[model samples]
Target: MKKLFTLTILFFSLVAAAQTEDATSSEINENATFQRWAIDVGAGVHKPTRPFVDGYVSTPDLWQADLGVRYMFTRSFGVGLEFGYNNIQSDADASVTFESDYYRVGLEGIVNLGDFVNLKSASSRFGILGHGGIGVGFLTSNARTLTDATDHHLNFTAGIAPQYRVTKNIAVFTDLTIIGTTRNHYGWDGAVLGTEVRGFEGLMINASVGLTFYLGEGTDPADFAQDPIEAKVDAIAAQMEKMAIENADDDQDGVPNYLDRDNTTESGVRVDSKGRAIDMNKNGIPDDMESSLNARYASQSDVQTAINSANAANQNQIKQLINEGYVNVYFRFNSTKPTTYSLGAINTIVQYMKDHPSATATLTGFADEIGSPEYNKSLSERRAKMVSDVLAAAGIDASRLTQNGDGEDASVDKNSTDARQLVRRVTFKVN
Candidate 1:
């Protein structure tokens, strides 16, 4: 009994020292959670590790088989306790071989390092995994030979198992283990007439086999998720690319698209015809827009040397936009009526006002003057007032809005009706 108790304690320590597997799926799924518990049963040959004590009588047989069960706390990790019966043999002096069986309870720690490695997670239908653990047990003999005596002792073991996942709940695994023992139970005893006992005593050796089974409730169907670290990194990279597209300065200059003073430089001293930075106009503004009419380049950096300047954009800039309050509104054809989609934009504006109560907005409205200036002027004023009402409804203080009307007088395109219509729209310039 003392031997059994010591063996159990040794097993516990072995299991305690084994490493635990980390959670694989990002989210917790109830079914998958249950798979955390599993049971394993195995059978294999055993070799004792000791000296000067023989379980085998003279001329007895030499090998024994062992059997046991293990319980897993995690699909990827588990610990097992088991017992086995053994047989020891001797050489021919007509000396009889002693036979006996030992009862054992050992704690085993295990890990599943998936497909490419050792173990599998229930989340993946097919994955590879690896597992390892240590165990200890008790031994005793029930034989009549004077030298065939049994005593209390402990067994130490280490093993490596590599398995394949057939399903989230089931898997087939194989393992090789090196087992060790604390006492000698195979060498010469007082009954031995020869100089040496042919049988071995305490020793360390290896064995291998394959097993298949269900993990348990913890390894449920829903425990897995689409959240792989590789996928997350890929998504981040894609977002960065999109930002590069948005911040590319249309007019090639040292400054980026977000900082450009003139977004579309058709006729501006700050930009060129292609909407690039240049001082050809002689004015401080870019030459491309001014077309040699005025502005001059302030510095060489201000010059737009390349037309198709493709520079990588910064992620922080895009992230900053998200962090800061922002609103994007898309309008319909020549209609001043606010659509449902505009509510999203209005909500953002509302948030902005809540965050910065002192912020101001200028609501300016324009109209294509196909009609008389008198009529268009009134139309523009009405449109501006309409927008003002929306902002007020959304919680903006009415007093913060400075309203203006540009009656068909200014058009983005003097030649096209559509372009003229586009110019005749409402704009809120926040300050």
Candidate 2:
């Protein structure tokens, strides 16, 4: 029993490792919510229907406890191993009193019926699972009229666990199962002459309450939620949260760096409408320009710092126009299809154009230098027109938006992935 328990632990540890490694698959486009693993530990009562004979009477209620670990390969099917202890009290019909204590271990296939049915609501708090398996059963017992020895036999177990999900990390569960072990021939010699001898010796029913802990990096409730609505809401919420982070103003300035004309302004400092730091002492000159002029007059070494600051402000202004006043559309290699991830970018552009009815945008598309010049040029042109059509469909006037393709001539890098990524994008400038 000890060896089996150790083996069981080792087996589950391997499965847990595999589960973590295989949880996220690159081939699948769906989210990682389907990958899940859990450990269940529960204790319950065990009732021996009969020890060795068909007509054996019931004894004082027996008891049992179990610990199990499972890995769900999918939403509905999973496999697990369980190990536990069971104590059977002595009892008799008209012939003998039979008592035994057994160590149980089993490998079970689990089926989650809730996945197939709409039994759970979007926020349902409970779930149900069914499992069954076969393993070795080690029994140590002494029968008054039959035998007194330790025996091991093949055992089969089937159970249903109804679980109440208390939170993302914890759940309460009750398992109701029937376990049957191989017949004990040594203790059955003359126990009951007239008792029918079935192939199996003991039939025990066990009911236990335990806790299940979900594991891995994806531990949120939404990661395992089965309801379509709940899953969709969770997915959308995640995307929105990500976008908020991507567009957050780390410096707490009113304008985010993605849309800030000047991102270097210190916190609590006053700024111009354009987001540049105010020149309190200089006559209406921006602080950055005054600093740059002063540095140039003092020394060339300080001039580089001033130039860098000016360049940073200029880059911020460009980003403010591109990310806030306009929008960018990204494309895949050799295709004009806009990426789904860029939908938020398109929406931002549309909203900006709507707010400023007189605003016009010039869309320019470029391509990496991967293919022939002719092919790259055409791909970029198609990509630019696709963006124009998308904007027109979204109520932007076609006359206000003009598009052009720069093709490989605008490639940031021919070999570097980081640089070429920008080459495959379509950007717009407010006109």
Candidate 3:
């Protein structure tokens, strides 16, 4: 009863800690509030501290195995109790025969150090933990010499042990304890040191192992969550976030140090508003479905060709988004205007926006080297404004635009020559 009470107190301490969310992941997600249980079976050896209990009256400390169960009230907290038996042995000379046995039951609190904050997914996830708890045990044994002339007694153990959890379902631990047993007596075998000897009584120390299993039914976290479908969804969301950051400007050319030939390009795809394609009519199936379809129709192609091209583009675009993002649209050097060659790119991006209409677009501008801090600032702003203009013209809802400019402020590299050129681009984002 004392063991149970002490364990309960420790258990409550961990319970308080669990009230907080997976703090970091709390904003990410959470699993359902549920209860779980686990069972473990293992073996261990027990050794007593004192060599003499009452002359030769001692018990053999033999190995034993037992089973235990754990109950998790939350993903981060739980409690467990286990019971087992140990055979106490005496010296081989039979100075004392301790054929009897003693059983122990202990209560320990379990702390889940970590767990999947994503509760929406189904999977056998893991968590780390450390626990400390107090336990009480009862020990009884008999010493037989030439007869079953035995004596037995019960005792209590009080101690606090610290454990490191290996995972949500398993743990390797050690217990530090001081076992308090009732005093007993035994007759001396003979004179040991000119005077008769009896038994020695005191507290004993014992170490043990522990393991736990999560009884929750489902797929593993890796296999279930963060899969292809979830990845796509998250990609879309990330893509939207990117657009919101980019659409703050629409010029598509809201970038400096470079020029792209297209206007009213996709939200996150940075195209130059000034640099028209020398190929003038240069065209390719936009890496996006909407783009491909629009490009096909612009060429006055067959409707069937447009559909096929769009389908192909959509597949490829999705692949890229999953691997990179909806549109890994980065600007080239010396470019501040959308090049005509970017029509296809614009088409691809616009289609994504159309598909996810609720998303907002954001635009951020950057400048490459070659301009003073103040000059780069204005240049970047011009670039971003150009992008905003084109996006607004592209039929995107004006209200969804989140245009902004950082100028040369957010340069990627200040020392490198090409840094300014690369930084001269405007980024488009949707969120």
Superposing all C-alpha atoms, what RMSD in Å does each candidate have to the true structure?
Answer: 19.5, 20.0, 19.9
Q: What TM-score number comes out for model 1? A: 0.37
lDDT per residue (tens digit) for residues 18-118 in model 3: 55534544544434323256675555555565424444434424465556676654555666676656665656776445554556676656665433344
Off by over 4 Å in 2: 1-31, 53-60, 91-98, 142-148, 186-201, 221-224, 227-431
Candidate ordering by TM-score (highest first): 2, 3, 1
What lDDT score is found at residue 71 in candidate 2? 72
Top model number, TM-score: 2
Off by over 4 Å in 1: 1-34, 49-76, 90-96, 113-149, 165-170, 183-201, 204-210, 218-431
What are the lDDT figures for the candidates, one per model? 0.47, 0.64, 0.48
Question: Tens digits of per-residue lDDT for model 2 on 240-302?
Answer: 998897678765657666667866544454676656657776443344444533432322234
Give the TM-score of each candidate.
0.37, 0.44, 0.38
Give the candidate order by descending lDDT. Answer: 2, 3, 1
Report clashes for each candidate as comma-separated counts: 61, 1, 80
- CA lDDT, candidate 3, residue 396: 71
Q: State the lDDT of candidate 1 residue by residue for 46-109, as single tens digits.
A: 4444443443343313344434455544334446554544554344453544444554455555
